[model samples]
Target: MKPRFTALLTLLVVALLGGCASQPPLRQAKDVDLARYMGTWYVIGHVPYFAEKGDVATADEYRLKPDGDIAVTYHYRKGFDAPEKTWAGKAWLPDPADTAHWKVQLVWPLRSDYVIVDLAPDYRSVLIGLPSRKLMWIMARERQLPAAEYQRLLAVAKAEGFPVDQVRKVPQRCEDLGQAGFEQP
Candidate 1:
């Protein structure tokens, strides 16, 4: 009985700690332009989860597949010595309110939320969020942008309550870009 109580107490503590962890919040699309929003985006920021706590310079691209469903590819740079890690998934627009925003039903659909938040005026960059807003990814056409424009977007993200530091600079791989389709106009 003593051992069992100790184990139960430990489990409770872990659960409580987990609950207290910070996460990105669910955000509404201030505005969306479907045509401009379509295309690949490099992930810049996300709330940390236990599995990939030390990842950096990660990015993701979203494309509308030939069949109309959405294709998602996640890329992460694990430590300086390790090669980038990549994963792919499929998603679709589910909201009757807006077709531009979507819900991805990947193998581990419940594990992540893929919400398209903001899009560039010219459709160059986009902001996405996991369902819980615990994770977010900002993608752009260029690996780097003008400092002023970048700062403006960062401010927008901050107003939305995301950890701005999580938005890191992702190194572009031309080979990967070839795999992602052009942004729909």
Candidate 2:
């Protein structure tokens, strides 16, 4: 298998097996307006996945498909000067009534729950997590968040059953690239 494929598979498996300790049930965000959530969200912090290891300028973009599924794009770089690596995936609401719960698939026949644990009313901030608390992401519309705001998001994740101590802040200091030229295979 190619290194990228190995990394992606490892990510899905680790997210499922990471948090083995028994814990309280994870809660979904009260509401998620898919329309407002569609855009590039900078990954300010996260419990790093294999694909994201040593990566910087990480972000996820969501586009609504006509079928009500989401067209997902993941962008990352190995270093400040590294050309960006991009990939396409798909996400869909398993239950229409539960908009916060999503089944995301990057590789065929392998899907993981991408729950919206918390979302700001203004759509500027969001917390995405797994039911097992194994993985978590703190994202915002802006690449950099105020110190206080970042801390607040961490607190929220902790309250929501995440292992905040394991969270790593993703570096967003890379120079702006008008368009990334590489795609993951």
TM-score for each candidate, following the candidate numbering = 0.60, 0.87
Candidate 1 local Cα displacement, residue 90, angstroms: 0.9
lDDT of 1 by residue, 57-121 (tens): 46666777777677876566555456877666677767646654565543441323355666667
Index of the highest-TM-score prediction: 2
Model 1 weakest 10-residue run by lDDT: 176-185
Off by over 4 Å in 1: 1-36, 51-57, 79-84, 109-111, 165-185
How well does candidate 2 score on lDDT at residue 63?
Answer: 98
TM-score of decoy 1: 0.60
Runs in model 2 lying further than 4 Å from the true structure: 1-4, 18-22, 174-185
Best by lDDT: 2
Local accuracy by lDDT, each model: 0.54, 0.80
